[model samples]
Target chain A: MRQILSQFGTDCDSGAAPRTMENWYEHREMIEINIVVCIKQVPGTTEIKIDPQTNTLIREGIESIINPFDTYAVEEAVRIKERIAQQSKEGFSGPESKVIAITMGPPQAENILREAISVGVDIGVLLSDRALAGADTLATSFTLAKAIRKLEREFGKISLILCGRQTLDGDTGQVGPELAQQLNLPCLGYVIEVMEIDNKYFKLKRLMEDRYEVFRVPLPAVISVSKGINEPRVPSLRGAMRAKSAPITVWRVSDLDVKSEEVGLSGSATQVIKVFSPHIERQSEIFTGDVDTQVEKLTQKLQSLGVV
Target chain B: MDYFLSDEQKMIVDIARKIAQEKIVPVRKELDEKEEFPHEIIKEIARADLFALFVPEEYGGLGGRIFDVCLAVEELSKGCLGVATSYAASGLGFLPIIISGSEEQKKKYLSDLASGKKLAAFGLTEPDAGSDASAIRTSAVLDGDEYVLNGTKQWISNGGEADIYTIFAMTDKTKGARGASTFIVEKGTPGFSFGKKEEKLGIRASVTRELIFENCRIPRENLISREGMGFIIAMRTLDKARPAVGAQAVGVAQAALDESIKFAKTRHQFGVSISSFQSIQHMLADMATQIEAARALVYAAAKMIDSGAKEISAASSMAKLFASDVAMKVTIDAVQIFGGYGYMREYPVEKMMRDAKITQIYEGTNQIQRNIIASHLLKSA
Candidate 1:
């Protein structure tokens, strides 16, 4: 660190004025929003089988599609961008908005990227490599966080990172919050509506089990959206044509500066010993009596079971 | 059942079917009951580039023809014949531009229609001009740079909704059919207005209204082809479009058949499923067979039109005639198969039957279609 500072000092000493870290770069308020949306491709159907030995999903025959929930995220992102444009037209625009969707998968996964672009995404990036094969949620988040940092550097500061609350195949929704944690940013999950947004803060409606909760969180945060955010629009003819020929940026493990052990199954924090489907073990009791008698017996049974 | 559709054709079916099933089916009942237009679904169709199936690739379309349009119409009709009618009406509106418009007109209007930015409606039918199209009273008189249009178009589908209109009117009434000329009119012209939405027994999801053009003046440039070509343009456009109506009939009949088969399997009587009965089985078989035959004929006719086959008017009339009659019969049988439940509004067969009635009546009544088919037969070898 001393040697590097001295070299910098010697360069400044060559007839340059004294400079401090604070004064080295000019500071300006940001009005443009560069967003990163994390999306994934999952099987079109849920009738996927799990390999007993690997305890992993067997995806050879099934067709792929954008995770249904992620379409809501894509829709919300486009809505946000449109809202920004609408604000500008009304002279109330706070931040310029652009959306970039990224997915980590095999080469064929690029189709989902094009699908995203067809729905109004500005561009797409694929983090594809053999090293990203069997990543559990944690490793997946770690890898995604790394790519986001790289994107933030390449395309200015990112205002927000959007994601689906949960993927269809992996019902575990740890990736969104985990990515926020890995990047040390605020995480807002289960967002159903974005009531207000600007460069500074965003007012969001988050869905709970019984009710919806509202939060006013600052921008530059990671947000996961539920399906209720908005209905996804169909791809416009022009948008689809544009997406067909649109160029997508591809990044490998080396490009993202991620080590092999930190991404794939080797770096996963948990291991699955077995994979199986759960079935309900239902038992029924039949009452033999007239309707009134059956009702009385049912009430007595409920009272005995303490369910009343 | 097998049309041996190419991969692209099959893909068109799959995409349209997916949209119809996922988007249209859910709200079809409500749309019918409320008589509401499906603005959002049409936008979805636009987004999916289905509207581009009608125009050529040079005009910002998918470069497909009537066959492709039929494929999509059949799938969409499965969801709701009314919605399908709205889309088909828009195609009918702009098809004149494709068939007869000059390069400048095509350049100016076709792209917008092709891209789904604007919707279109045809304005040829009048209260007095049902089968005798040459008798239309709508008049367009030239005045310097414009032609003043005076008349009304009755039962115009997408009447109040579409932004563009292709209207037929008499330029020189003394010349009879030769006096007719086609004109492209915008929806919000100074003297153009619409009447109240008409109530219908079926296809209630679609709107039917009257277009009143009282001293409506349009640019002379809007005249399609020439002053005396209106009837020819209208005829040519209908020749290209009749097979699509046949496709719609096929789709609606297929939907009825689909509901009947599903109902039959679960409905039980005499301690066995009704599907097990020979009479019910025969009805189901006949309905399926009729739909398949209708589909085949519609596809064959659409192919002939697309291929530029000469004297295709007869084939077009045959497809529309046969398929519509088949649709009416199949839907009735579907109701019959459903027994008492079929008469109830809870089931969809009754609505299918109502929708089937219009396919036989519109474009050209089945009687007119028969006349056309016989005329061509008498002239051929």
Candidate 2:
């Protein structure tokens, strides 16, 4: 195998194979892995206010950041790629892999793509169009699936898809499952750790409320990563500078070859009619007594109110 | 009046500000109280690629300039001046190599420094030479393949922790100021050792110690450029680095003013918020104006240096002098605005006041900075 590879005129001696040869070798080995990370840009501040009348976020003067959870997905994808590359260098013959970050929002959402690139993503693709505004979870998932297919067309078959368990703003843990359904792939939710992975299968730890279960899943799957996957690495200065000049592939609704009525707000099965802040009424009752009596009274009040 | 930052500059500032707020601010008080060297925070900063801001791209750096360094320093200093000093002092340490180092020397030293794999320290000031750098008593005698150095360097920032030191010593005693030469000394050289750490008043979170060189031998190739060029290199490196100190001052001042404004609006006096009072309003106004002016000067000096200006001593000194003064005044006024609470450590204003004092003293005292400005003015006149 080494002789055949060397005969291909690959400068493998320098440890950096040419892109075309590397891709060709991956194809021949039947172990190429492409990972697509679905990310979103949300308001930076947690103190977000919704305009009661308009039912829209007060976005003016607010900065946007990549959804906090999605950062873990990005970090995990990069880590997997790095681990595979390391293994290949150590003669384990692991799959050649790439981590591509994708997002769907307005053109300004490109910022998050650049940010992900700075962290370690190999490629950034933005699905931005006016028609894609006000997308519900289902519509967003559909759009992301289309984007992933587009990426596969350009690169190669994607072996895995990753997303955060839920977005901070929407808090809907639906996109990963919906996207899996759209793409006809097996879905793994709340994946806290990737125990081991090879070309054909992955061993993962699925986090649960009371316990964690280990599962062995086949390749070509979707995983919605939980926060405990890993601590995301900060962007290196060199990576940040590269990201500043990196060309982000921008896809419109047309680019995805989707029907106008099958995406964005128009394609949504559900629409939010009203958004309002829940009203909280504050009431204080003073209990004047000795310490033990006050404690007894508080415990009785808590039991009566079912607060225990 | 029109100050515009490029997209890249804005991105750099944003990243630094995020690290400052998320990592530095939380540990600042504890670090200051314990006088602990912020190893973890520094590692985070290194991971963030901030160490490469001022290094050239060919030398494994980000290819940014002095302006970028100033921008990062300003943001980081806003959280804690001590942390910012640790960050900026490394730049001061390695800048001599960047300014006058040979291609070989740069490749050897700057690559590691730029990658943040190793930290660097500048050692121009000694026990006898603080503002008077020409009075440095450290002597380096020529050997077959090395220069054997003998002297003690005082008040070196990042002294004990840094892996490399750009030290200056007299190579030819007969030449007076012209006799000095700079050499790169690795931390673990045979006779080189560190003295006790100094307990400082402000910027206490940063390490300061004496670098004692008793027959500390370094290869002749470690000498920067040529012999008898040490004073000039040291001066030039300081000229380039002074604006960053200005940026630190600006950050401290801005933080103080921000605290003052927030305090004034919330703290009530005579049935109204103190901000509504004329006296408080005037103080806030003056603080805001001074901080803005100092920031403007610092930015201008940084840009001038980045633009490859040949003579920028006056501008750099002016920036350092004015910004440090503004930092001191604004922090004091912030305390005044906070009234009695400002005097207490519970409020952040007192810490800001403490942190603001060192910007006036180190990197050349404000008095020495005034002297540089006067000299420049006289030469031009």
State fnat for each of the candidate structures.
0.38, 0.50
Q: Kindly report which residue stretches of model 2 are placed more than 4 angstroms away from their true locations once superposed.
A: A1-32, A43-65, A82-96, A106-108, A128-143, A181-186, A193-206, A212-218, A228-245, A252-308, B62-64, B378-381
Candidate 1 global lDDT = 0.89
Measured against the true structure, the TM-scores of the candidates, in listed sequence, are: 0.87, 0.84
Which digits, one per residue and each the tens of the lDDT, describe model 1 over residues B291-374? 888889999999988888878999999999999999999999999998899999888888888988999999999999999999
Q: Write the per-residue lDDT of candidate 2 for residues B215-235, one digit (tens) a residue.
A: 888999999989999999989
Candidate 1 CAPRI level? acceptable
* Pairs clashing within candidate 1: none
The segments of candidate 1 whose C-alpha lies over 4 angstroms from its true place after superposition are: A1-34, A43-64, A81-99, A105-111, A114-133, A150-158, A195-205, A208-219, A236-255, A272-283, A296-308, B2-7
Error of 2 at B268 (Å): 2.2
lDDT of each: 0.89, 0.89
Residues A19-111 of candidate 2 have per-residue lDDT tens digits of 464465553343458999999988999888775654545556789899999999999999988877865664346446888999988788899
